[model samples]
Target: MSLRETVNSVDTNAKRQACMELINEDYNKLGQYKMGEVQSRNIMIIGRTRTGKSTIKLLLMDPRNVPDEMTLKSGTKDPQFQTFHIQQQEVVLNIIDTPGLFERSNVESDIRPDEAILKGIQLCANMEITKFHAICFCVALTSGINAQDVEAIEKLIAFLGDEIMNNSCLVITHCESKDEEQRNRLKLELEQDTFFKKINPFFKLGVYFSGSLNSDDYKHGNESLKNQYLTISDYRKKLLDLFIKIEKPFPISEMIISQIRQANDSVEQKTVQLEDEKQKNDELQSRIKELQEKYLKEKCLADDLRVKYEQQERLVTDSRVTHGQREGQLKNLQEKLQQKDNIIKRREKCQAQLGNDLKKIIEMEEHQTKKLEDNFYGRLRSVYDADKIRAVFLIPVRRIITDYLRYVITSFTVVK
Candidate 1:
């Protein structure tokens, strides 16, 4: 085989081995890894307050209705982490059901949302987990995303970086009733959201109604719980379907050629991006050279304008100084002329005033005028007798009260 063929063959064999190895880990590990064995994916179910993180965990770990003793003993039913091997695929899943973060009452000063997500990431990283494989951000189907949910999800995306999101899943839990319409609406909303829009392209995303597959009244064999069990089973199958897809080898190979094609496509995309960047850099260099030439021309023009402006300014300043001296001399002459004119006017004004004083004496005699209407009785009442005025005011009030009493008596007969 050619070297390229040999490498492709090796990759195919390695991928097959990885698939087998993952299946083995799921069966033999009993959900607990051997001291040094690695896992395929450690799924951390995270969300804001009461959004079914625990429900997702329970469904994943105990889909057969089997309880994990160690996790049960942990006594944190709401917040838990458990390792389990999924059937068939032998995918060893380390699942964490984190509690409602960003609650005012439940928030711990030390245990922040960042810490929770980072701890999950660290555990996966320590286990030498290359890919998250699947991170189901559990959101309640009944409610839309809140601020805290946004904050926690934002932090998680940042913590896991872009790779995790590419391989992530969105698990909507506690979906209301048999209404797929509501679930569909929620899914539409999530897709439209900016964060999910960015994440959706990378990850396999879908919406699920929890009670649809499992009736709320599920009884193991009992008819009451049977419906509920069926509903649960339905949801379980959905979960299985989701994780199975995630646990499958990245860039899956149901057929040999598809895997090769996906690989080729990835390479081609990278190559195109690289070529585009190179083109952008060359364009930027050309633009920069053009700008530099234009800048030099502008600088030369600016220098010439500055020299011309400075020479003109000097000429203006000289002219302004000479004009100012002439203006000052003219102002001095005008001031002397104005002073003489003022003295002459002052003498004329004084002579006119002496004549005006005598005319005022005659006008004052002619200007005397008066009105002569008389009110003879007005002077008598400035201080009237206080008793008289008081009686004048009290008379009408007394009459009104007397008339009111007479009217009330006439209007209503005595209690009969």
Candidate 2:
């Protein structure tokens, strides 16, 4: 080969070795990067403010070397990524440490800690980490359980889901000086808490205690400090083992986030629907009340009208009775008046007949008296002296006959 070809060949081999080393580094730091193989086990540490979430991450990264002041005071305001390499078992651990969920801030920002953490998880997809092998919920042993802790846990469960609880574990920090008995007592207290009781069944990985000594204590060569460090290391090691042994990983992807948003929207819609239904029910009840009042008023009016109608009917009946009595009385009065008129006509007719009979009797008496005088005078003249007979007999007989006639007439008139 020529000089130029040799130089090119050496450069090519150097580049090939460097690439192999890079690939090997990636394989050791993360698990086998090959598709379909179990890669690095991803873990997310979550907790409220100042609960030692960052401290736990540091200790897990280097359990033998105590964290310096810088690492201890490094409050994570954003998601921090770290990798742990276990060359002996060829296991890799990828950890994402998030900001405290309940950290107080004077400056209000649009992105909340929880929202930022979700964005960080989304960024992990670019690194080929689509799921979390485990979620560690860190709570300080010194900080007694409070409402804030409960609220943070509830928020996490709401955002992620109850499925996340299946791969979760509790980490009690600040337990460096606590004895086994004290730790057990704290655990029992946690179990007894109402909020913990509801979610205890979902913690499949169980609880753990993490305690760490400063670097200064480790450098003093004290046996007790060394033993304490070993115990802390063992606790962290067990946590890693648990992560590696997880059978399934909780998915963190855009699709999952979308699903969570949809669920929240559905709950809001149901709440609105319930409010609308309650309002409608109230309106219907009001309408019913109005209708009842109207019905009562109408009923009262109907009753009054019925009473008046009954009264009018009674009046008409009474009037009819009075009218019938009046008609009968008028009929009797007419019959009496008719009888009086008939009696008056009969009396007038009888008076007229009596006057005619009296006139006829007077005429008959005058004619009879004249005839007797004429016959007596003729007889006296033939039998005796005319002058003497006329003077004596004529006078006496005339007087007697007149008297008799008067008596007869008076008696007959009285008898008739």
Best candidate, lDDT: 2
Q: Over 4 Å off in model 2, which ranges?
A: 1-38, 68-74, 108-113, 215-223, 257-416
- Model 1, range 183-223, lDDT digits (tens) per residue? 57877778788666654544445555453323323324435
Q: What is the lDDT of residue 69 in candidate 2?
A: 54
State the TM-score for model 2. 0.49
Error of 1 at 84 (Å): 1.6
Assess the local accuracy of residue 100 in candidate 2 as a C-alpha lDDT between 0 and 100. 75
In candidate 1 the C-alpha lDDT for residue 289 amounts to 95
Residues 1-416, model 2: lDDT tens digits: 99999999999999999999998898888966454433578888877667788778777777765655533233877777778776655667888887777665656532344564554565465566778888888888767667666666676777677888888888988776667788799899998987777657766789998877755566786677766677778777888778767868988767765664565467579889989998999999999999999999999999999999999999999999999998898888888888877876665565456546755765575566557666777777788887787777777776786677678657655654
lDDT of 2 at 346: 68
